[model samples]
Target chain A: MSHVGYGCLMAVDREHVLRSAAALLTRRATATMDEVAKAAGISRATLHRQFAGRDALVRALEELGIQECEAALGAARLDDGTAREAVRRLVGEFESAAGLLGFLYTENQLFEGEEQNAGWSRIDARIAALFRRGQESGEFRIDLTPAWLTEALYGLFASGAWAVSEGRVAAKDFQYMIVELLLGGALRREES
Target chain B: MSHVGYGCLMAVDREHVLRSAAALLTRRATATMDEVAKAAGISRATLHRQFAGRDALVRALEELGIQECEAALGAARLDDGTAREAVRRLVGEFESAAGLLGFLYTENQLFEGEEQNAGWSRIDARIAALFRRGQESGEFRIDLTPAWLTEALYGLFASGAWAVSEGRVAAKDFQYMIVELLLGGALRREES
Candidate 1:
């Protein structure tokens, strides 16, 4: 029991450190390790012990993004309602991580010439599965493939993040805009 | 006159060199200036004369992208047809430069902390104007702003380029996927 408690404490500390690191990196992608340590109110030595370098920190950020995405998916209950509603729920839940994910999405150097972390594949699969479910249920059009839709989701996520960062898109509307555009598109649906 | 003939020759050569540079850089954004000169079959001196360094080369590429976008916009005839049809034509014409445009879109270093090229404003206003036309004609839903639509177009262009590069999305489907997704969305339209 004592060992389990100790393990829990370490995990909690590690998560706190990662969260602080992510917050700093999201604001300034080029921030150095020393700055990260400063922002987290920890010693540079401790930061080094946790993440040895910039690349390692980015990898940790990528891991954090994946964990949060999984958590959001779990909370979204994407299987509970109409696929459209489920998408709305997913987008709503996913909005909090938009900044972090946007950073990871555009940080191409970390991904180039390397096989992406398997966590992303799992996340993509889940999202694509949701799109497939919509298609199977006749809610989504069948012409666009699930893979394409999944890719488009990431693209929109990055674009929406870009818009918000540029002060062009309001943060509160990120979820509404992304979900509406992805699901309903820009055309006026003629009501009967 | 001989002067006019010489100027014309210089213009053609410069455009040719820029086109080759664009093709190479689109394939490899990290390609060096020496490699660009080599690929363009021009001497380093000539390449340097034309572009003093990578920054200048990139600026030239940006100019090329702007010029091509203008040409595509001209060919698209954004003013002549129904907004929907106009968007389709615009996307079709824009497809040829997707690779080069995608390069410029993601090259954040070239644009960060710098005032964006004025050419983009002209291009964006034109595209946004097209969307506004759609909204006024009741051809598009109004909840989504024309600015957002224009921003989304750039996002989709980058995404479509990315998909085609990864072989996940076929080249033939590039225009179809982008146009259909941007206009019609993913929902199955109810044929009333």
Candidate 2:
């Protein structure tokens, strides 16, 4: 009981730090570790006690991103409702983490040659499965493969994040813009 | 006439080298300068005479990317027909240069903190205008802003290019996938 209690306490602090860092870096990818520590509402000495530098912080953020994605997937209940609805829910749940995901997408060059974290593959597989379900259900078009749709989701998330950060698009509209563009496209649809 | 001929000849060689470098780097971002020289079918000495190193090579490529984008825009004739047809034509015209655009998009970190080339602003504004044209004509959804659509086009292009490069999606399907998803989306529409 004592060990479990200690582990839970540590995780809460670590999670808070990761969330704070992600929110800052999502908008400003070049922010310093000191800024991250400040954003997390902790002293620099306390922050350094956990992570060494920006690189270490980013590595931790990657793990946090993966965990958050998994949590979103679980919370969305992807298989319970219609795939389209499922997709909408997933995007909404991801709204909080989109910034982190965007930062990771742009900074992927860091993992260019090195083997990327395996967690991404896991998250991708789950999302791909949802798209596949949509195709099987006849709710989606077949010409665009599930794989392509999955990749496009990542691209849109990055674009949406950047657009919001640049103030070109309202942050409030991020989920709507991406969901509408991904599921319905730019063309105005006639009432059926 | 002699001076014009000399300039034209130099321009042709320069264009050829940029295309070759863009093509090679698009597939393999980490390819060596020596490899780029071989891909361009030029000697290392000759390549160095033109550009000293990879940094100079990328700078030259930036100019080539801008020139190619401007050329595509001109050839696309964005105002010629229905905005939809114009967009389709613009994308098709950009096909040959997508690889170069993709390469530059990923390597954009190299330009961070520096003023980006003005040509990008020029290109972005033109593309945004096309979306604005479409919206004004009721051809597109007004909720999705012109700026967001333009950014989405760029995101789709990068996604399509990456999908093609990775063999996750077929190369031939690149343009169709991006255009269809951008224009019609993943929903199956009832034919009017």
lDDT, candidates in the order shown? 0.85, 0.85
The DockQ assigned to candidate 2 is 0.49
Best by TM-score: 1
Q: Which residue pairs clash in candidate 2?
A: none
Docking quality (DockQ) of candidate 1: 0.52
Predicted candidate 1 versus true structure: per-residue lDDT over A61-91, tens digit per residue: 8988999999999999989899999999998
Candidate DockQ scores, in order = 0.52, 0.49
lDDT of 2 by residue, B27-137 (tens): 777788889989999988888888988889998888898898999999999999989898998888888888788778767644556877888899999999999999999
Best by DockQ: 1
Clashing pairs in 1: none
Candidate 2 C-alpha lDDT tens digits along A1-192: 467456545533877888888888776777777888899999888898889777788888898888989999999999988998999999999988887887887666445668889998999999999999999999899999888999899889887877787778999999999999999988899965
